[model samples]
Target: MNKLIEQQIETLVEPLVSEKGLELVNVEYVKEGAHWYLRLYIDKEGGVDMDDCTDVSHAVSEMLDTKNPIPQAYMLEVSSPGLERPLKKEEDFKRFQGSLVMVHTLSQFQGFKKFSGTLVGLINDEIVLEYENKRVAIPRDLVKKTHLLLDF
Candidate 1:
């Protein structure tokens, strides 16, 4: 049910995002305690601001309300994916090259599931990373999650 709702939302919002030159990062429909939340994470080359959020929110909200896609009510949230955004796509890894990223593997590598450092390269379906003064190649399929890291 949730997946279907997400699909519908994605279909409904694709036009709006493209029209505004924004990238739709992800969408989630989840229940937190008593509240149902439909969260939309968006981004672009220059990053998104509140005005962009507001516009997307208004447009999506109206569309959802009209279609009545979900049987239950949900609070809609449209916003940026943030600096530590998840690297879920190959395009993301390609675009974020040379940036710091943290990756968690499905199984332990070097006796650990988590690895953090610079994303040196992504080639041949593997991610090359430099961490702890050593370079390691991690298979892309092994990564359970990958997120950008903030450097101060």
Candidate 2:
């Protein structure tokens, strides 16, 4: 059921995102506590603003009403991924080179579960991280989560 809803949302959002000159980072339909929330993460070269989010939300809401993919009432949210955007794709990694990043590993490395350091580079499907005055090469697949950290 969740997969069906995700598919429908993707179908409905792709066109709107492209028309708005934004990239669809991710779409999630999940039940949190007693409420179901549909979140849409959008991005662009310069980043997204409130107007962009509102526009996408309005367009997506109208389309979802017509499609009727979700059975229950859900609050739809459209917003920027913020300073700590999830590095969900290879393109994101490439796009955010030389930025501070926080990464969690599926398996512990260096006796630590998380690494917060400079994103040195990506080479051959591996992420090179500079941490603790040393360089660590972690397999991209082993990363559970990777997000850009704001310096401020």
Candidate 3:
């Protein structure tokens, strides 16, 4: 049910987001305690500002009202993906090469499930990373989550 909602929302908002010169990073519909939250993570070449979020929210809200896809009440949030942006697609991996990243695997790799290193991009079906003084190649399928690490 949640997947269906997310797909519907994605289909409905992709065009709107593109029109605003934004990339639709991800869409999530989840329940938190007693409340349901619909979050839209958007991005651009630089970043997103309050005006961008407000515009998207207004546009999406109007579309949702007319379509009425969701039955229950939910809080809709449109915002940037932030500094620790998720690296989900192959393009993302290539684009963010040389950037610092943190990867979590579904199972232990080299006796560890988590690794932080400089992203060396994808080679074949593996994600190459420079960790410590060595290079580690992680199978794409083993990756549970991969995101950029913001160094402050």
Candidate 4:
């Protein structure tokens, strides 16, 4: 159900984000205690500002109100992906090449499930990471999650 809602929201907002010269990084639908939340992660070349978030929030709120796809009440939030942004799409990997990243896999690789290193980008459906003075290729399908690593 959460996945379905996320998909619907993503489909509905993709065009709107693009129209605003922004990129829709991701959408998440989740319940926290008694409340539900619909979170939208957005980005652009220079990154998002308060006005950008407010604009997207207003636009998405209007669209959701009209569509009424979600039966229950939920808080809608639109904001930037932040410094440690998630690396979700293939293009994200390519774009963030040479940046530091942290990756976790569904299963262990080289006796470890998590690794942090310099991102070498995507190659042959694998994410190459330069870690421990070596280049390690992690199969894309095996990755559970990945995000940029904040140096500070």
Candidate 5:
């Protein structure tokens, strides 16, 4: 159900953001405390600002209101992906190649659930990372989240 809602949202917002010359980094439908939230993480060449957020929020809000794709009540949010921007697509892996990253898998692998290391880019269908003087190839399907890690 949550996946469907997020898919519906991404389908609606991806092209809209693209048309605005921005990237829709991610979309999430999550429950926090007593509220449900639809979060849209966006980015541009120099990163997004408050005005970008507001504009996207207003545009998405209007679209959501018109389409009524979601069946439940939720708060809409638009914002940047922050320093630890997620690496979602193949291009992201290529663009951020050699950068530091942290990857979390859906289940434990190699006696660990998370790894912090230098991204070796997507090789074949795996996210290769060099950590602790060794390299590991994590199956992309097993990766629950992959984000750039900030050293500072």
Candidate 6:
């Protein structure tokens, strides 16, 4: 996946997503086997249905066609983030506080690269978690991914 392209798509699609009363959860531009894919994960307070995905896909597809940001051919996919929702923004940490989450760091922290615990919150550029009955504060800069850990 190209992070740069994903970032660019996020920048371009966020407003349209917001306009449609949705939160743009995540974006990815990746190659799988012989095909390239651009995926957009969106959400709302009540979660989204297939119709929502199709509507957003059409809107986003038209936008991308107008902009032509990616030079190569790729399939566009729009869908919900699912049960294990990603924590991608500061607000997400605050919103999902007290939820179980798995966070992956760019570098090892306390001899480990991943931490799973209850999300305390993001404070002062650090993500605080209650892991194994202890409070662990991880620098946000080092966090590569953070997502809800489904208890089910």
Scored by CA lDDT, what does every candidate get?
Answer: 0.88, 0.87, 0.93, 0.94, 0.94, 0.94
lDDT value, residue 53 of candidate 3: 95
Compared with the true structure, what per-residue lDDT tens digits does model 4 show for residues 1-152? 89998999899999998999999998999999999999999999989999999999999999889989999999998889999999988999989999999999999998999989999998999999998899999998999989999987
Candidate 3 global TM-score: 0.88
Ranked by TM-score, the better of candidates 1 and 4 is 4
The list of candidate 1 runs beyond 4 A from truth reads 1-4
Query: Model 2: per-residue lDDT, tens digit, 49-68?
Result: 99999998888889888988
Q: By TM-score, how accurate is candidate 2? A: 0.82
lDDT of 1 by residue, 1-152 (tens): 88788888888888888898888888889999999999999998889999999998998898888888889878999999998998877788888898999989999987889999999878898888898899988998888888899998
| Candidate 5 lDDT tens digits, 22-131 | 99999999999999999999999989999999999999999999999988899999999999999997889999999999999999988889999999989989999998
lDDT of 6 by residue, 1-152 (tens): 39889999999999999999999999989999999999999999989999989999999999999999998999999999999989988889989999999999998988999999999999898999997789999998899999999986
List the lowest-lDDT window of 10 residues for candidate 1.
87-96
Model 6, residue 101: distance off in Å is 0.4
Candidate 6: where are CA atoms >4 Å away? none
Q: On TM-score, who's better, 1 or 6?
A: 6
Residue 121, candidate 2: how far off, in angstroms? Answer: 3.3
TM-score of each: 0.83, 0.82, 0.88, 0.93, 0.96, 0.95
Give the C-alpha lDDT of model 4. Answer: 0.94
**107, model 6: CA deviation in Å?**
2.7
Give the clashing residue pairs of candidate 6, or none.
none
lDDT, model 5: 0.94
Evaluation by lDDT, superior candidate among 2 and 4: 4
Local error of candidate 4 at residue 18 (angstroms):
0.8
Off by over 4 Å in 4: none
